[model samples]
Target: MTQTAEAAAENLPARRESRAEKLLSWLIRGASPAASHLLLLPAAAWLLVFLLLPVACLLALSLATRGPYGTVVWSFTWANFGRALNPMYLPVLLRTAAYAGSATGLCLALGFPLAYYLSFYAGKRRETLLVMLMIPFWTSCLVAIYSWMIILGRHGLLNDLLGRLGLIQAPLPLLNNGFSVVLGLVYFYIPFMVLPLYGSLEKIPRAYLEAAYDLGASPAEAFLKVTLPLSLPGVFAGCLLTFVPCMGDFLTAEFLGGPRNFLIGNLIQNQFLMSQDWPFGAALTALLVLSLISGLYFYQRLEARQIEP
Candidate 1:
């Protein structure tokens, strides 16, 4: 009787699990295709309301004309876009691209080795190091930029330290230049590059490296032939993450690079705020959005090709 009671008690939990699983399966089977799609309504509505609607409005605004009094007129024209591509603004656009590209390159150079170290050699300190790396994000971006200003200003920390060390009699002119803008950009965006690279490198199995070793390949050869190619996806993601935001950034150039270091973002901001030329600003914004979208499309095609046999 005792044995039978124990057996029944053990079977009770299994019976309950089976009943629950059966209920789940029945619910799934009974769900209509329309009902399944209805589950996506909230997410679809969010994108439509927040993303698509704003972009459509921007496109419409870009096609509209600016009144002589600086009001937005409903008249359709391509003049705004043409004006955006004028030689006057072409140099600014090119400079913005150059800054973004420089920052992206520097980030890749720094982040790849750091990520590799974190993935393969950080050992017990990996989590701690990662947390430290992310610590800068805890504060506001403006705060970070202000800190950089303090460090880079003529009478700032770096200059004071150098002066005390007798490195120079005069303070270095570090602020308000293209170099400062790019430095700010690299400092801010390098973490974005490192995290993605670390994720990619960490996912690579040690077995692959071991296999490469067994094939009489040196460590450097193994890394070059096996690790680097597999990590290209991370490189692509990191570059995309770094470059796009760098191109659109205004604060770094505004605070560090000053007027001479103006970027596309600064131009758009001045157009909308200072000049009250919303149509032209919208056109510039639309062009930037289109360019980013085209890049994304190309990346997708490349990724698809890589995935195919």
Candidate 2:
């Protein structure tokens, strides 16, 4: 009877331990799904609060009317959107598109070679080059744009250099023109273009090139067929990065471009700050956002098709 009682005492501890382990296991199992959702909640909430809410408000404002006192009126109206489509605004939109498109093309032309060199030929200096590329971003964009103003102004560095070199009789009208605006846009956005191209180019295996060479393909052929096709994703990404921001860049046009070179960004800014037409400005903003989203959707579909076997 004593031995039997001792065995029962030993079994009680084991049973308790088993129950504790089961409880822990069940807790972990049940909490895993909830924990994953909990982890996503902050990001979802941030998007909802910041991005979606502001866009919704902007959309609502776009649909409403502007009051005489430069305030938003809650009445429904399509006049704002209709005004945005007028012939006066079409030229601004076209010019904006032209500048952005030119910048994107120039970025691709300049950045692709640099990225290709960095990926294939930089060797141990790759990191240094990348660091140098990123150095411009360390400073404020406004400061950089202002610095360009100094360099490109009539009496500024370029003019002084030209004078010393006897290149021209007078300081060229370099600043406050379309040329300067495009140059500023290119300078500011080139790094964005390069990084994505580098990412794509670096991922192309050397073995693929070697295999192509073994099959009697020249370097140009290999690049044209293999490298270019594989790198389309990066090219599209770079274009989107460069183009979207360039389209909406008011500061570059404001400082570098004169009154004649104003783009959609400047127009929008004027509507809001100078004209105080909140409804029209909101309509313009909504249109720009929707257009960009539509372009992105089409690009994404194209990318998916390109990636498919």
Candidate 3:
């Protein structure tokens, strides 16, 4: 009798909470469509003031002309766009694409196995492993990049270890190159790839795998046919996440790649900051945004085709 009373007392607050939630939900459902629209006004207004305003300003700036003294003039011209698209800037754009693509590929290769292991084989330790994977995000990105510099620098950890092992007479040229830039990008963005892949992989029902096995399909064949196809959405999302930022990353290239491996991002940064050419920088930014939008459109088309009956 005492235990039953205790149980009732314990559930009383939960019951009250459930009733309160039901009441709130009922109130919301009873709200008029005009009221519902009013609720979204704040968000819409926020986007307009913050997002749309800035973008409009940038577009205006991109269309405007730069003065002789580096001031932005209200006069309109397409020269900035033409200069950004010219042959002289083609190499920078191409290099940006190449670096971003390389980093995306490397991240996919590394993240897939990690995600696969976490989803399938991690068993009881999945949460712990995930925490470890996310630990890097707890600190500043600048600190993480600086740590890589310490590891890859001429007198840094790797060179010291290699020297100790009698690997070579001189410190290897590990830093200030394309390799370091890509390495930094992969290190920074691998989590973005892994998390999406794990989300998709984990959602795949175990029963499907069991059914495949019951149909006399080998593990390799089953994975190739079922798991890979099911995980393509995650792969696409991960690649998109990694590649887009890499294309606009000036810090990684500036710190690790130096002058010779200049990507479009560095060029944009130079124009905006060093050269004080706001119009040209805005034009380049617009071009980058357009390219990304085109890629997104293609991705949507591909996704839609895959979903077609």
Candidate 4:
């Protein structure tokens, strides 16, 4: 009877512990919803304060009038926006688009083969090659651009070597043109193109390609029909990444390209710095942001259609 009582005493504590745990879990589930929400609120507030606040300020600055002292006045004017929307700005926008388009295409074309070879063929060296691609990004983009100018200029290695080989009678004109701008853009953005494409291609299960090949489809056919289509999202993402940055890049054009190659970013810079017109600069930024947002929205819809049944 004494042993039985001891067992009952042990069982009572065990039962009590189990009940306490269950009650605590229930309480946490019920009462902790607001506590969890509190965690998310800080990040939301940070974005509002840092990101959205500046955008709000820029918009306000765009709408406000500029005083004689270049101070923002509390007056609404459509003139800043109207100048941005004028037809003269159209060529600048189109030229920027053209340059950005060429660079994006080049990045995709060059990056695809490297990404493919590394991801699929490099085997043990995939990580190493990826590291190499990322290594250039560690250095400032301006430094790499300066290096390109030296490499391609008249007294540069390329021209010197070509002269020795008698391939050209004169030093080639590689700098200070749209071609150089495109080259710089592609060089800077190639890594961006590679990573997203590599991600998409990596997610493509090997069995799908094997199945396609086993079913009498050739290598090219399998890729065209299955692999490429599956990786469309990555391609679109890479294009957008290249396009957006290329559009906003003023430094590349100023350093590598000449008088005929000023883009919207350069124009925006001029308005802000040289002209000392904060309102116009802000207006241009707002318009560019809208264009980017609209582009992304359309791209999302296109992606949805492809993924959906």
Candidate 5:
């Protein structure tokens, strides 16, 4: 063979062998890069056995029929699902949604400024102020409900003050209705809304705000154009957390609002407890989960859109 041709022939096999070795290396990596991932197996098994299994059971109960005694009759039926879609249920669902939405909106309105102030202006006292906010987290939410009752009841503080002022012959209808329920929900959930917003707002680079100021933008303009928009993810996250819990919240509706305001949570609680309708209650629980999941899905979609160009 010619010297050049011999060199080419000799090198071609080496190059081909190198390519083959690389392909083998990639195949080996692709097949078992996480071969020691068996560490996750136990946790996965625990979740399946506990969390997922219970949800599966609840879902099955939703699909199954309720017996005369409200037991889960194994005879499969979609009647429960159909009943949930009825107009009567629709109104309750809508009312709950409206209440939750309003609470979320109010939470954002009230929490946003406080969170911004703490994050941007509190400075050396930020830790102390933030610690104060977390004090409520340590307390029982149920206790707060009772406290609200004491404050909003007929002989409560407002009534005493107003009666002294001769504003009315009787106390206003502040308790035992939708308004107080919303108020309690707002009070209970405001911290949830604040913490997330504060977290997001705190992370906002000082450089961005400085840039806006340096570019001759006013403080108001800097916040609106830079701070508010950047902090929206936290706002959205907090709203979602607050809204979902409020929708499914029974205690707030029951303790403060009493009979005039019965939420879906009350109904579910009744079906399972007093009514002896486990299957029906399970169905109701499933429906609540589904609704929450749907709402979360939409919220996440909106968040994604907010993120996109």
Candidate 6:
């Protein structure tokens, strides 16, 4: 009787283990392929509703004709695209490109050193410094730009300071110019550049630098040969981030620039809001989007080629 009891007790644990395994298997099997795909439905719906739908509408509108009273007429037309490419708007496009390019270059020049320092020299204070860098983002961008306006304005704080220091007889004409617009773009986008660069620099191992030193390479040579090449990805990412948004931004030009500093963004805004020409505005927007996509595709191809063995 005792031997029988021992065998039953051993079989009881085996039965429990089998039951647990079956329960897990049943749970897994309950999530059918259809149900698994259903989990993606909400995200797919959101993209369709918010992103794809608007782009489709814009595309349709761009091909439609503008009515006599700014309403969109259903008649198909390519005049809007031609209007966007007209000589009148070409300068605005060029100016936008120049401003964005200058801002990107300045961001790269300024951000690289700051990122290098933060990644390599910050040590325990890295977190604190990064938080400080992010503090500007918490404030409203418009408010920050307005503050710059006050500072850069004639008879404002800068002028007052200069007067008190007896540096100049008159206040400098700092506001409502290309210089001010570029300043605002750089100020707003520098952090974007720095963050990417810091991410790239942080991933680089210190051992590589040590090895370079051991090979009797100078610091400059080591940096140019090893560090700079590895950090190109970050540089490209930062430039894209800064340039793309800067190209589309109108607020900086509106607030900090005068008539002469008008950009493509300003022209687009004027088309939709001031002129109420939705078709032309949509065409301009579509062109900008296509240009950006083409640039990104080329960049990706270049990156792929660089990565090939």
Worst 10 residues of 5 by lDDT: 31-40
For residues 98-157, write the lDDT of model 1, one tens digit per residue.
999999999999999999999999999999999998988566889999999999999999
Off by over 4 Å in 1: 1-30, 305-309
- Error (Å) of candidate 2 at residue 300 is 1.8
Candidate 6 residues 233-284, lDDT tens each?
Answer: 7888888889899999998898888778978888889889999899999999
Compared with the true structure, all predictions reach lDDT values of 0.91, 0.91, 0.90, 0.87, 0.87, 0.88
Error in Å for residue 214 of model 4 = 1.4
Model 5 TM-score, 2 decimals: 0.85
Any idea what lDDT model 3 has? 0.90
Task: Find the 10 residues in a row with the least total lDDT in model 2.
Answer: 27-36
The clash number for model 5 is 0
TM-score of each: 0.87, 0.88, 0.88, 0.86, 0.85, 0.88
In the predicted model 6, the residue pairs found to clash are: none
lDDT value for model 4: 0.87
Residues 1-309, model 4: lDDT tens digits: 999999999999999999999976765676767755665789999999999999999988888777776677778888888888889886887888789989999999998888788767999989889999999977798899899989888788889999999999999988888888899999898888989999888989999999999999999999899889988888888888888998888988988887778888898898888988888888888887877789889988888888884
**lDDT by residue for model 3 (1-309), tens:** 999999999899999999999866765785676656666789999999999999889988999889887799987899999999999997889888998999999999999999999999999999999999999956688998899999999999999999999997899999999899999999888998999999999989989999999999999999998899888888888888888998889888888887799888888888888899999999998988888889889887887776563
* Each candidate: RMSD: 7.2, 5.3, 8.1, 6.4, 10.5, 6.4
TM-score of 4: 0.86
Off by over 4 Å in 5: 1-38
lDDT of 6: 0.88
Candidate 6 residue runs with Cα over 4 Å from true position: 1-36
TM value for model 6: 0.88
> Least accurate stretch of 10 residues (summed lDDT) in model 6?
30-39
**Candidates 1 and 6, the one with greater lDDT:** 1
